[model samples]
Target chain A: MESHIELSFEDIRGKQHATLIHFIGDLDATNIELVLEKVFNLINEGTVNIIADFKQLRYVNSTGLGILLHFSKTAREKGGCFKIANINENVYEIIEIIGATTLLEIYDDVDEATAALT
Target chain B: MTTQRMEIDIQEVPESEGVVILHFSGDLTSECVRRINECFSAVGKKGKTYAIANMAEVTLISSAVLGEFMGCRKRLIEEHGDLVFCGLDLEMRTKLHLMGATKIFRIYTDIRTALNSYKWEIERQPEKFHVSFPPYLKIVPPLRQLVSRIARQKGYGNRDSFRIETIVDEICNNAVEHGRPKADDLIDLTVIIDPDKIEIDVRNMSDPDKVASLTAMLLPEKTDTDKPKPDVKRGRGLSLIKMLSDGMSVECTDRGTSVRVKKVREE
Candidate 1:
């Protein structure tokens, strides 16, 4: 699938603690690495908390879900939090069925997720 | 310019009941998946949960499309709906069946039948021999005995029987761990003893991510990978399976995940 992943704040302020990522297009074996690379870069850049905006995410395969698990775990290990927001009904149910929702701190939208992170 | 390898047309008739039919013509090689996904995404955005993909016009299909189907199925099922395929030619149907998609989808002979049959779910038809196992105690011995009995019934010699049993061992071992099934879940073991080959499938309900990792792990590296060290914790079962079976593959479906291994009997 043609997965388009965009990470906001290519250039970030040194004091900025939280980041927002807008996930578009399909998330599968093909596109997950590109998406994860950006997520990892943000984490490595010392973004304490990240909000993965899934407002436009159309498809998420198992690999994508696994990437999310890795994202959450890495953020937690670093004393920060990784959460999700604005996911459609399908993505929400997929995560819920897989029992990964418990591991993720999810919110309704990016604004709510960011407000709580701050 | 020569014709494109694929053409995708979305048939979104007003009364299709949340179903969108993607009609594909031309070759179904890997390059076509991106086009399929783009049209599929459009359907998803419209809140359509069911799809009837008509591939009759397509001359051929590939295993890559099977993986693509699994992705689309997950998205649809996540919305409490399903995806069905129809009008696939015989070669494609045989390929789909070999890939064990019959267990995942309710494929029909035509679009009308496919659309009408979506009222309920459909699973694979019964095979000649089948067994169900609980992932308790040692799983190999019982499965070995079962395979041996079938092999003997089919007049398989010791060498052939042993080979089949070995494949069973490798696939079942991986299924037990990676399947991560719940208490109520049972590992379904099925044997399809065709005239010339015996196909074994092990099905279990597990996390999609787990299945994805297993598929990725077992996928033969484009460049050869070095053997894992003794202390290494992974890739052992998949490697053993690839060594033993003539063919083996895993698929994660809306129902669950299955690992299928086939061994052809020598004349």
Candidate 2:
């Protein structure tokens, strides 16, 4: 299969404290780099706080998990926050399996992740 | 070589004779998986489940076929039968072993040996049916319907069966589109269903480079894409297959490439 992800941002709690990245489609070795590079660019832009929305994600492989970890780690190094929202059951299972479930702040929805981070 | 679309034949060993086997030849793939699903649905309609699959002549297989195999095996086991595979070459056995499927399915060296393993009641099986179609894009839908009907007939819940249908749709579309098929070019598909497992094979005349590219990505542990480029289309079909099926394999040859996929149903 191929890979597709739409990258976009929204402000949470009417404030621009965090960059809410909404991801759609499969995330694997094929396209994980594109996503990570975007995250790096967002951090460089000084919006260190990130809320990754995965509600629309169809799939994620091991490499994608690594990129997610790298995203969070990079945010932590910058003294900012990295959170996630709306992760579907399938991707969540893989996340849990990799023992990274506790590595990030998980919210049931984008609004929650946004509110908490902001 | 010859542009033969594909063919599906259900060869049932006579009841009073030897063990019952569903023999499949030609290309076994997602498109063919539907036919295999239909055969089992037909078996399910008759309220039977004991099955053995013979893959002596199967030259190709796909991931959807693997998913179907596992689904059917689980169904058969629930009904008090087992899905056993026989007549596999060393390469096929290694493929199953590598995918960690050998632990689940009963493997045999040959039909005679597989039959000798147990005395199965020859359940007056239905006559085998065969169908062939062009590799053209237009006919893919009806082909997928055959698999969807099998899932429904096998009593799969709506969502579960739909997943199976989608897998078939994705692979067949790829097979038709990616195949550097000349005019009148055909891909062969075959599905064999038994109480234990379902087998699907797909064969296509493909450029060696295309085969190499797919094979590399198919192995995830040692993986990377050909190169990072703007993927105009992105929905990892191969990854989805790896996630869903019990096992899969790709065989590349000078003439063409064949892929076989098998799945062991959850008990």
lDDT, candidate 2, B219-239, per-residue tens: 757332432222223334555
> What TM-score does each model's chain B reach against the true chain B?
0.48, 0.48
Q: Which stretches of candidate 2 lie over 4 Å from their true place?
A: B1-264
DockQ of 2: 0.05
Q: Per-residue CA lDDT of candidate 1, range B45-101, in tens?
A: 998888888888987777787789789889889987777888987888888889899
Candidate 1 — which pairs collide? none
Docking class of 1: incorrect
Candidate 2 local lDDT, A1-118, one digit each (tens): 3356778877655656577788887675546667878888889988888888888886665456667777777788888888988988767765664456777678899788777864
**Candidate 1 global TM-score:** 0.35
lDDT score, candidate 1, position B54: 88
